[model samples]
Target: MTLEATDVSHGYGNETVFDGVSLSVSTGEVVAIIGPSGVGKSTLLRLLALFDAPDRGTISYDGEDVWRQPEGRRLEHRRRIGMVFQDASLFDASVRRNAAYGLRVRQSWPERIRHGFAQLVGEQNGTGDAVEALETVGLADKVDQDADSLSGGEAQRVAFARALAYDPEILLLDEPTSDLDPRNTAVIEDAVLQARDRGIGVVVATHDMHQARRVADRTAVLLGDEILEVDRTERVFDDPRDDRTRQFIDGELIY
Candidate 1:
């Protein structure tokens, strides 16, 4: 599967955020969007996640324009994609419950009732895929703890686990580890690579250049309200086609 944005442009009223942006990510590939803060990276991810419509272009999944589809079809497309935001907006519930939230909401009401009854009777813990996802984020032991009591980094890990539990075909992350410590950041990066190995298309919008180099198969540079370059990770770092890309990679370009 491929998730693509073609000639995509967006803005807030009269102020344009980005224009004429085109990018694609295929299954089993990781694409990184790198830019300084406020460069519209988050906005681009939102468009790719099907959370918002592009003002002047199309977002396509498998060659079909997503926004042009009927609401039911668009909804099905959204169900196949998962997004993790910068903030870990977890509910005031147990870690296990939070991790399984995505999957739970997608279930039929009757199924949810059955599961609830099973949990009540001790027939199941209701962990299901949440256990594996939490383990991937190194939080398997914290499954029964209150999500509200976790540290910031732990909370973010829970958020990533929640997204992973649904087994999305496309995963979009927006600066998921910006505030995490090195150890926690490494865990998240490993989970990302695992997702890629499972043939999931991953697009990560990150300010961490080192993280991009470590995890992305392809890197794209967004600057001056446009995509300046997109190429293999090593080539983008060592031999950027655009001087601006070189400047950005060398930390010489100031936002």
Candidate 2:
């Protein structure tokens, strides 16, 4: 599947945050959007996740027009395309609840799994989807533990598991490891790679150059309310055609 953003533009109140932004993500590929602070990296993620709409453009997922869909269908599409935040928000409830929260809330009745392998396949614990989600993030043993008891990295992993449990088609990450220490950041990075292996289109918004080099197949630089450049990860880093990109990579602020 391919996610295409055609001329997507958004703003708040009277200020324009993003305009004329265009990008795409193909299946099994990870695209990293990098930029300076307050440059709409997270805003783009929110727009991608359908948390809000792009006021002037179209976001197409697998050829279907996402923005034109009705609210209920849009909600369904949002689940299929997941979003992870910078804070990695996790509930105080048990790991089971945290992982299964989407399913529980979306379906009204608890989500049911047909077999045990289903859970194990998703890298979860013995509890099925919820546990499997945790296992995917290497949290099988802590499936019954409280979300509050988890460390920063562990909580993020649980939050990621929640997104995975929904069987999302595309995974959107906004500075996924920003809150983690180096060790935990490595852990979450591994989890993300695993998710990609499962054929999901992953889009990560980050300020970390090394992280982009490590996981991104392609990289896009967001600056001056636009996507300055989008290309292969190495190409973007080593041969940035844009002057702004060169300066930004050299530690000069673009905005």
Query: For residues 1-255, could you state the per-residue lDDT of candidate 2 as single tens digits?
Result: 888888999999999998999999887989999998899999888888877778899988888889787888777777788878988788777888788877665554333443234555764433477777788788989877888999888888888888888777899999999888898788778877888898988999999989999989999999989999999999999999999899999998635
Model 2 scores a C-alpha lDDT of 0.84
Per-residue alpha-carbon lDDT of candidate 1 for residues 1-255, written as tens digits (9 for 90 to 100): 999999999999999999999999898999999999999999999999998999999999999999999999998899899889999989999998999988888889999999899877866555679989999999999998999989999999999999999999999999999999998899999999999999999999998999999999999999989999999999998899999988888889887
**Candidate 2 residue pairs in clash (backbone atoms < 3 Å):** 123-135, 123-136, 124-131, 124-132, 125-131, 125-132
Worst 10 residues of 1 by lDDT: 119-128
Model 2 lowest lDDT segment of ten? 108-117
Q: Report every candidate's CA lDDT.
A: 0.93, 0.84
What TM-score goes with each of the models? 0.96, 0.90
Q: What is the lDDT of residue 14 in candidate 2?
A: 93
Candidate 1 Cα misplacement greater than 4 A, ranges = 120-126
